[model samples]
Target: NAGVTQTPKFRILKIGQSMTLQCTQDMNHNYMYWYRQDPGMGLKLIYYSVGAGITDKGEVPNGYNVSRSTTEDFPLRLELAAPSQTSVYFCASGRQGAEAFFGQGTRLTVV
Candidate 1:
């Protein structure tokens, strides 16, 4: 089974469009995180889920939302797309104190 998976590796959205980036892990991880990396910038945390039915906002959660209905899935939704939100998003899952398994990443461009 795959350790972690993310759909729509690349996408371009309009100024006001919306989309959900899908993430799933087969490792039954209790911690899942979403991060975005802009050009020439470091990764910024967007949202995270500790376990099933428990989710929390990260540093840059303003324009995004996440839901963790199951331990294996944590999807990120982007509302009201904007050019400033263009970046590569990564989904990661791991245990409490171990290394996380990351998805290939979704490249989003808002034009």
Candidate 2:
């Protein structure tokens, strides 16, 4: 089974532009999360969903949104991208506190 996948492994967006970073998993996990890892930094949670149709904001949810409409997919949306948003975005999933599997990641840069 494919653990996880993300499109456009790297991207450069002008300020105020928008984009969606897609993530999918075949593990049928119940919990999915979005986190951003800044250069030489630890991950900061952006959003999470316990199950399909239920989602909530996390530590750094500004300028970002997420939705889990199915068990296999969760995508992160960025509106009005800013330079501060330049970072590596990772999509992860697991059963609660279990070890979360991560996607290869999408590196985004806003100019």
Candidate 3:
């Protein structure tokens, strides 16, 4: 089964455009998260969900939103994107204290 998948491996966004990064997991995990890593930096949480229909904001949620509507899907929405939003987006899933499986990542460059 696919552990975690993120679409559009790379994207270039102009200022003020919007996009959605898709994430899915087939492991039936209850915890899912969206994180962004700037060049040569650690991952910062943008949003997370404990289960379907339950989402919460994390460390960095500005200009971003999320919805978990099913057991396997957690999508991150970037609205009114800005140059500051340029980063590598990664989707992850796992139990607490467990190893989280990360997506290949979506590289977004907002110019």
Candidate 4:
């Protein structure tokens, strides 16, 4: 079941440009999360949702937005991109005590 899928494996955005990173999971997990990793750093949570229609901010919520309208999809929106926003973004889903399934990742570069 395509555990977790992220679209546009890679992208480059100019300063001030905006884009949405798409993620979808077929595992039917109720918990979904968005995270970002900078070079030589651990993943930092960006946003997460316990279930559809319920979302919460994480460590770094600035310049980003997310929504969970269904169990299968969670998209991350970046507005007015900046160089500091360049990083590898990941989407994950899982149960409370189970291991999470992560997407291949989206590498974004803000120039």
Candidate 5:
């Protein structure tokens, strides 16, 4: 099964543009998270959901939004993109206290 899949591996957006970074997992994990990594920095949580219909904001959720309508999908939306939002975004999932599996990552650039 596809552990975790993220679409649009790369994207370039103009300032103020909007986009959705798609992610899905077939592992049926109960814990899912969205994180972003800036160059030379550690991963910063953007959002997370423990299960469908439940969500919470994370460390840097200022310009992003997320929803979990099903156990398999968690999509991150970026509104009015900015240079500071440019980073490598990752989606991960795993059982509680277990290792999380990550997607290939979506590299986004805002000019």
Candidate 6:
């Protein structure tokens, strides 16, 4: 089964375009997260969900949003895409205090 999956492996957006980055996991993990990796920088948490109906903002939540209505999906929404948001986004899932399973990643560019 797919541990985690992200759609639209690559995408380009106009300055103010909006899109939703889809992420889903089949591992039945209770925790899910959205992270962004910029050039030469470590992954920065964007948002996370502990379980269905529970979610929280991470270090960089501006211009983005997320929801966890079920244990298998956590989708990240970008509003008014900006160049600063351009980065490789990774969706991960795992149990608390354990190693995470990451998706191939979604490369996004805003110009």
User: Where's the lowest-lDDT run of ten residues in candidate 5?
Assistant: 92-101
Query: Per-residue alpha-carbon lDDT of model 2 for 42-101, expressed as tens digits?
Result: 999999999999999999998998889999899999989999999999999998768899
Cα-based RMSD of candidate 2: 0.8
Lowest summed lDDT across 10 adjacent residues in model 6 is found at: 1-10
Which portions of model 6 miss their true places by more than 4 Å?
A: none
- Residues 1-111 of candidate 3: C-alpha lDDT, one tens digit per residue: 678999989999999999999999999889999999999999999999998999999999989999999989999999899999999999999986788899999999999
Against the reference, the lDDT scores of all candidates come to 0.94, 0.93, 0.94, 0.96, 0.95, 0.94
Candidate 3 local Cα displacement, residue 99, angstroms: 1.9
Q: Model 6: how far is 67 from its true place, Å?
A: 0.8
Model 5 agreement with the true structure over 1-111: per-residue lDDT tens digits: 779999989999999999999999999998899999999999999999888999999999899999999999999999899999999999999898899999999999999
User: Over 4 Å off in model 4, which ranges?
Assistant: none
Q: Which stretches of candidate 2 lie over 4 Å from their true place?
A: none
Task: Specify the poorest-scoring 10-residue window by lDDT in model 4.
Answer: 93-102
For model 2, give the 10-residue run with minimal summed lDDT.
Answer: 1-10
- Pairs with backbone N, CA or C atoms under 3 Å apart (clashes), candidate 5: none
- Model 2: lDDT equals 0.93
Residue clash pairs of candidate 6: none
TM-score for each predicted model, relative to the true structure? 0.97, 0.96, 0.96, 0.98, 0.97, 0.97
Question: For candidate 4, lDDT tens digit of each residue in 19-68?
Answer: 99999999889999999999999999999999999999999999999999
Q: Measured by C-alpha RMSD in angstroms, how accurate is candidate 1? A: 0.7
lDDT against true structure, model 1? 0.94
lDDT of 5: 0.95
Which residue segments of model 5 deviate by more than 4 Å?
A: none
